[model samples]
Target: MSEKKNTNHGPQKGGPMGGFGAPVEKAKDFKGTIKKLLSYFKPNLVKVILVFVMAICSTIFSIAGPKIMGKATTKLYEGVYGKIALAKLNTQKVSLEKIASMSKTPNPKVSGGLAAIKAGIAKVISETGGKIDFTYIGHILLMVIGLYLVSALFTFVQQYVMAGIAQNIVYDMREDLSTKLNKLPLKYYDSKTHGEILSRVTNDMDNISTTLQQSLTQLVSSVVTILGVIIMMLTISPILTLVAIVTLPICGIATSGFAKKSQKYFAGQQKAIGELNGHVEEIYTGHNIVRVFGREQESIEKFEKINDELYEVGWKAQFISGIVMPVMNFINNVGYVVICVVGGMFVIKKKIEIGDIQAFIQYSKQFTMPIVQTANIANILQSTVASAERVFELLEEVEEIAEDKQPKVIELPKGEVKFEHVKFGYKENVTLIEDMNLEAKPGQTVAIVGPTGAGKTTLVNLLMRFYEINDGRITVDGVDTREMTRADLRGMFGMVLQDTWLFNGTIRDNIAYGRDNATEEDIINAAKAAHADHFIRTLPEGYDTILNEEASNISQGQKQLLTIARAILANPRILILDEATSSVDTRTEIFIQKAMGNLMKGRTSFVIAHRLSTIRDADVILVMRNGSVIEQGNHDELMKKNGFYADLYNSQFSDGEDVG
Candidate 1:
């Protein structure tokens, strides 16, 4: 069945809405997945440490800014206030001197008060010269600016180093995924949709990359900022620091509540996106079929349904998560009011300076942001961990069975093959083929004919070891196929299936894909032999014409011919053709048959055909029914029997069928 038909279009089970909805994709083992993810950082440990140091330095420098700026404020205030005090004190000094001079018998109280007044006035005049001191404030401003510049410099360095670390780790992850994909068994591919597998490699990996590049460093900086701000606030006024902290529990409660509500919606959104992507990919690839069947409206309707669901969940997810910041800001603002009132009282009591009050308020504001950032990062980390777990799950999947430690070598393959007592099934306890025995001598053309799902393609799959048999062995040149490496075993055969596969590339490159290091002359010769050379010369670019992603530029018959050319270039000792000429017209089929005949001249060949007359000259013909061969003989012998083969052959021609 097509993968699209097999896809589950509905939401997944075990969601918050019971068993009928899409559940959030969470890490089954958060700690374990995080540990595995961290392993990727080992190679860049030094860089990670440096990033940490830089983050701390940057945050510390930034945290010190408001406190240092407070000094400038204090210096300016002192100058302005001192000048005003000096003027007031001069008047008082004159009055006190006049009173002292009038009281010839100096009163002790008057004498002490007058002397103290004169001392204060002199001190104020000396400090400010009865004017504001701009020089002192200028120095303080420069110092603050210098600290801010250094902070910015540290931030830039940390970000640059962190981006490199993130990319390197993602690069290694991508390489590992690529390698793992190649090593995985064919059954794995058969069981998964192309979109599902691609999502893990592409979407999941991208999520990890984004989180690492942005969120990871932000998490570190947010933490340091929070700690550093706390310390600075405490230094300014411990009472105000306590007031700022009292609001944290409320922020935490609000964030946790919103995150819990939005997380499931986020998961639903992701699931819906996957479904939408799968639907689009499937419909696009099979658009021609859909148009022919007139199902465009149906496809659009299905798309709308999925899209609507995505929109619903997306808004809910975004709305719930979005409110967190505003709500947090509101709570922090209330806390800000409380801190201001308390700091003002302390200032009036002379317990803290005016500059200290200003610094404390700045620190209080700074304190709330990192807490919010940390909460947001926590949520992002949850999603990131979920993505990481998916990647790790793929890496940990069971791979193909290991090759033989000391595999036997095939010096020169002659294409002799045998399947003895072969019992097999795609699943256990459901045998598709049982007690099958077959052999083909070197250079013999053996044809297999059968109804759909009659084990015809299954036979070829077994020969190539795309699947392993349940009980028995297949041998090539009298050596058990299992004894040889899969590469060596598969390398001996060339295949051209009913469904052609051609990658996007030039005609020359596509044909050359059949054999490594194939010369240009070899590619053209193979094309000529498959009768593809004529079509190649007819194109505007000839062999240089680039096929699009779907290879839709060429006719179906042309694609088949190109595949045949590729098989020809391979020049394998064994050839397997499963309805290789099914897509072509009679004339093209005849030409392909001729090319195939020449290609199969000295190689053992297995031809699987639906057309009864196509394999009339086979050395041996095997007719399969329901997983077993019901008839085995050549054309003349099978016709004499008037059994299944004869009946099938006669039916094809009985209704005035156009026999080519």
Candidate 2:
């Protein structure tokens, strides 16, 4: 049980870094898992292509904004400088005119040359303006705004398309998983825990969904943004672009070192958390047993120990991962300073405009984020692929053997069961039941009595074909069980096991679960026949009462009665009652015994009971020991033979001991 629990409830694969502290679980076959995951998108290939196109368009539009906005800044700067130059030139023109007018018989040639130069300067000043070009700036601003709005629209479309594709693929995946679970053999479930299978279906599937919906789109946009920003930066100034690119290697080394260090702590934290959860689940579910054994304090101490370990590893993991962003930012800041200094030098040397420097700085800042995002996304993909691989593993599990294609149909099952030379085992080398043979006529009540693990229930399980026989044949109504479809063969019988299963619903619904299209009257009649109607009517809501998840609202005996009621409604040709009355009081047992007698009339019944007294009236008693029947006869005949059956019966009656 512990092994199964650990297999199922162990540390789950990590998701997108919850604060970059969760460990990323890598897939054993990364390329294979990726290929399989992509196959799921084949049906949505067109939509996927559309999403990529939209993402690229959106990113390209966004990348153009900084460069376009810089044009407006350039217009403003050129206007301001031109106005200053023009004003200075106007002052010089006035001084030149005054000198020419106040010549006092100056030379004519010199005066003519001065007049011509003054006229040319006046014409140049008039052709330009001493005020800023607000019109051009307004046009540039409008164009930038339009580009941003279009970018946002494209982003919305991209996300909308991608979301649909993700959900549809996940939907198909979940359907396939559900179907596969049903087709899996019982041995698979026997070797696994309910939690483990559920974790694969719920947690692992959710991880895949999250990655497809969010990370896939983000990865595309990040890559496009990186490429687009690089191009824009180079166009602005290749020298500044080179300066920004040089810092990347430093940032990469730092990030990789921190990620490796934090990964160890993150993995430790995850393990500790799983341990703590396991301890808490075990304690809470068995709290009564713990208290009865006086181990409450010990359990508490164990819980505290696990909790402390979790805290230690959790803090270290978070602290280490937390420093990565700050360190990367510092490196980026250094690169930004270098780019700005080079850009300023270019502007002063008249090699580049001030507005171009602004655009390049913006491009440089944009460049680093996508690179970081791509790295983070790469980590997220590792975890996502691991989840996908786990799910695929379950889907690829061995299913039950296929039913006969032309299966024989039993139109009216008579329930004459026979086992001939039957051999079986849970494992190949360890035989539990070997060469076992049994037979029951159409309407006989065959009682199977034995000690625990004596193959009493195994006999019934073989008769029902829950597990296939290793050798020989089992027949129902003179037809080989294997020749009939599993559904058709099992449909002829009704079972009430020791473990009563009741889902969360009304009592009426649970009883009616035995048959399709059962009317209210049919349900009430079955309940009355099982002797459960009286107690059920005494409840506050009677048949309308709702059962909780575990059906804990009802007593154990009441649960058994409900199950009997369900079997009674089924009214199958063969009835199996495996310790059905074990949980009830003696008085209730008598009621149940009478009900079983009535239900068994004209039907073949197999009763597996530990109490020898309960099956004395059965037509035949088969005493099983060591997976084989040691004796078989009626109660009186067995007593007369004075064999193993006789000793088992005498011991139970004389000492009031359950020989079963």
Listed in order, each prediction's TM-score against the native is: 0.88, 0.92
Error of 1 at 326 (Å): 2.8
Model 2 segments more than 4 A misplaced? 1-22, 88-129, 654-660
In candidate 2, where is summed lDDT lowest over 10 consecutive residues?
Answer: 1-10
Shift of residue 397 alpha carbon in model 1, Å: 2.0
What TM-score does candidate 1 get on C-alpha atoms? 0.88
Q: Candidate 1 lDDT (Cα, whole model)?
A: 0.86
lDDT of 2 at 140: 92
For candidate 2, what's the RMSD?
3.2
lDDT of 2 at 80: 83
* Model 2, global lDDT: 0.86
Tens-place lDDT per residue, model 2, 1-660, is 131133432224332334464566789999998999999999999999999999999999999999998888877887787677767666766766687687887767756766775665566456435568899889999999999999999999999999899999999999999999988877788898787889899888888888899998899999999989988988888888888998999988887887788788887877787788778878888889999999988888988998899889888888887788888889999999998888899999989888899998898889988887797788788878888999999999988878998999999988899989999998989998888888999999999988889998878777777677899999998899999988898899999999999999999999999999999999999999989999999999999999999999999999999999999999999999999998888888888999999999999999998788889889988889989988888888999999988887898878976433
Q: Can you give the lDDT of residue 375 in candidate 1?
A: 60
